[model samples]
Target: MNARGYFWRTVQQQEVDYIEDADGIIKGYEIKWNPKLKLKAPKSFKEAYNTDVALINKDNFREFL
Candidate 1:
């Protein structure tokens, strides 16, 4: 089956770097270009949408990719 979905910057601008998906499954992603940089996800990200939210760092970015 084929699914379609999209993710956008919320009004709060949680600072999501990117999002990836193949079906209806929603995956929230945060990309940090800098290895030493720090990123944080907004609380509303998970509750606002019925999707999975994750923080993507240099260490585990492959999992999300």
Candidate 2:
């Protein structure tokens, strides 16, 4: 688990449910309880750091775990 902050005078924050550094690559993930809700990684985080993002929910959480 990791929390990141973005600052440009005023500060903004984003939390990733899980993160891993594999071989030199950074991956980001978000977990949601609702499978029906379509979600994506935060735009600020994505734009700042180009990396893989994933959504874990009831329907597909098993595949991730």
Candidate 3:
């Protein structure tokens, strides 16, 4: 694989599912199986990395693909 690395992060109970190093771009994801549940953005990640995190769920998983 050409990806640089697969990363995981956690700050208390908040977390990122993974940060995929695709080529040179770092993509962050948080996944929820239940679309109806509320999803909170990982603010610490944005503050530390200056990157936005994407959410994946049953309702909108196709877009992530």
Query: How high is each candidate's TM-score?
Result: 0.57, 0.66, 0.70
Q: Say which candidate scores most in TM-score.
A: 3
Q: Is candidate 2 or candidate 3 better by TM-score?
A: 3
User: In angstroms, how far off is 38's CA in candidate 3?
Assistant: 2.2
lDDT of 3 by residue, 1-65 (tens): 57654556575777778787876777788889898877677888778777888878998999887
* Per-residue accuracy of model 1 over 4-55 as CA lDDT, tens digit each: 4456577766545565555656677767756676557666766766666666
Backbone clashes in model 2, listed as residue pairs = none
Off by over 4 Å in 2: 1-11
Worst 10 residues of 1 by lDDT: 15-24
User: Model 3 off-target regions past 4 Å?
Assistant: 11-13
lDDT of 2: 0.66
lDDT string, candidate 2, 5-50, tens digits: 2222115555666666665567677879898877766676666658
Q: Please give the lDDT score at residue 28 for candidate 1.
A: 74
Q: Lowest-lDDT window of 10 residues in candidate 3?
A: 1-10
